[model samples]
Target: MTARIDLTLDCANASLLAAFWKTALGYADEPPPPPFATREEWLASFGPPEDGSEDDGAWLCDPDGAGPRLSVLRVPEPKTAKNRLHIDIRVPGHGTPAERWHRIRAEAERLVVAGGTVLAESDGHHIVMADPEDNEFRIAANPAA
Candidate 1:
């Protein structure tokens, strides 16, 4: 059987990164565990971190229930090196290469408004972007095979 998988990102500000990712991927926040009634109640049970560290991160899930779950964690340090692995957002497109690029540009603009910055782009292929905290990701065409 295939093992279930999830994605986790460690960042200086989990909440910000999570928000950016949630918007970029069109995912929804993962609901609280059963019997909790609300996220506040669930979080209250932890009694806060001992050092008073910020804990505003969240777990996000694909609303369609097909993509892997994403968990954001707050870390004490800043990112100093490029990510060894990163997410590539596949946006559906059709028609000529210019048309595909137009779609990508539109999505990239929307993401920029939602807290992502375009780092670079390669014509109709892909656009590299960074989340609020500087973690890199990409937007690319999802052409049918």
Candidate 2:
């Protein structure tokens, strides 16, 4: 059987990161499971955390159900270093090299408006960016596509 995977990120603010990621990946807030009217209600079903601390997190999923779900969980510590693993937001299309780079820059600009910061740009390649919580990710156009 094929294994399914979900990506989880540790951040200081779950809601903010989730919002940024939603905009970045064209994902949406995952609704509570069936029979539950609200996320709070669904969470309540699991009872309180064993340690008595509140469970704080945001869940997101690809609207088309092709990508892995993302979970942003609140953590006490801050992000202190570069991410060993990061997400690559692929801009979809085919065009001349200049046109492709333009598309990448356009998407990067949109993400900046959505609370992402562009760290660096590789000409006609990719743009390195950071989400609101400083999680590093890249925006690029697939050369093969």
Candidate 3:
């Protein structure tokens, strides 16, 4: 038997971030952040970028309700130290390295505009970026070649 596992993110707000991860990983949604009236109604409405989803918390959920979940919690303080752990993403390994890089590059770019930041880059195929709340994640170029 195996134990279920999920990663906890002690950040600033849960509902706000849960939406971003929902799109990035194509995962399902979780309950809306705390303290909102009529949670379901609030969840149905998506806010603009300028707002930064600041009112709600965030989550990097597991779609099937399996696999590791990335839960973002709202904290009173900021992240002042480095993350002790992180997640790495590699697309299906089937194509040229360059193709993988390009595909990954586009995803990374979209994430950046959506409030993610690139922390490091290695050629076109390798790049590191942080989520809206500074959670570090990687998106590698095509692995389908």
Task: Give the best candidate by TM-score.
Answer: 2
Clashing pairs in 1: none
Better of 1 and 3 by TM-score: 1
Whole-model lDDT, candidate 2? Answer: 0.90
State each model's CA lDDT, in order. Answer: 0.86, 0.90, 0.70
Best by lDDT: 2
| Comparison by lDDT, 2 against 3, better one | 2
lDDT of 2 by residue, 86-107 (tens): 9999998898989999999999
Q: How far is candidate 3 from the true structure (C-alpha RMSD, Å)?
A: 7.1
Q: Which stretches of candidate 3 lie over 4 Å from their true place?
A: 31-60, 141-145
Cα error of candidate 3 at position 10, Å: 1.2
Residue 62 shift from truth in candidate 1, angstroms:
0.7
In candidate 3, clashing pairs total 23
Sort by TM-score, best first: what order? Answer: 2, 1, 3
| Range of the 10 consecutive residues with the lowest summed lDDT in candidate 2 | 48-57
In model 1, how large is the Cα lDDT of residue 40? 68
